[model samples]
Target: MRFVSKLTMALVGALALFGVGFATVTPADAASGTIHFSIVKGGFFVGAEGGNGVLEFRGRRYPLSIGGISGGLVFGASQTNFSGRVTNIRRASDVAGTYGAAGAGAAVGAGVRVITLRNEKGAILRLQGQQVGLMANLDLSGLVISMRR
Candidate 1:
């Protein structure tokens, strides 16, 4: 039993060190891109955009604005512009799935559905506008939506 406990402790320590290293990893290596998205009046918005920034996701730095949205609720027709270092990229589909699930789990999560619908609409608008190269979807959590150009 003592041996087992020691082994477990070692493993836990190693994991903790790995986590620290992962957190410090930078998210910018190449010239960052742009990211543009709108946040519905009521929902969580989280994302980043800029000429260069650091995005730590899944223990990797994948050139921000490369992925898409994560998850959350979206609504209405709104536009938010931000110019900065592309920090992270999360796929819209992924975010939708996560948020949808969470919203469903919560008793008052129906609001998520409405927000997500708005997000879809906003995404469509962004796509139709032909703003792809420097853009990405976000969850609107810690997102700072601002206009640049």
Candidate 2:
């Protein structure tokens, strides 16, 4: 346990020195990226969501895996096809962190959905997508995002 704690601190110190994930991100550090993700979720009053996505930034590609939980007056199941831009990227690793946002969207027939989220590292994502199926109510969701090698 002592060794693990020391290793963690050293790693964080190294990253901070190089200004990776431990600094405030400014517009100057922002890069434009696009991501396509798909999610499936279901439950009654409580729900879970999971999905995978690919991000294209500055001629490089990064794979992202996502998982999250949400609760509200939620019921039934729905799938969403999302495509959006990631912003405020201070470093490549900045995109790999938890993000939370509250949004309202429904696809009763034809619909439009948009949400904005920011993570601890100051990365922001503005996403717009289409939701299919039925699930209703307002909810706050926290998404844990990570980069897949």
Clashes of each: 24, 0
**lDDT tens digits, residue span 74-139, model 1:** 322223322222322333222121111122222122222222212321221111111222222333
Q: After superposition, how far is residue 34 of candidate 1 from its true place, in Å?
A: 2.0
lDDT at position 1, candidate 1: 100
After TM-score superposition, what is the CA distance of residue 120 in candidate 1 from its true location, in Å? Answer: 27
lDDT of 2 by residue, 1-149 (tens): 99999999999999888877744555675677888888877777788899988888888888889889887766777887789988878456778889886755455644567888888877788988888878775777788888888
Candidate 1 global lDDT: 0.31
Candidate 1: where is the Cα deviation over 4 Å? 1-5, 14-33, 36-84, 88-149
Q: What's the C-alpha lDDT at position 30 in model 1?
A: 17
TM-score of each: 0.20, 0.77
Candidate that would win on TM-score: 2
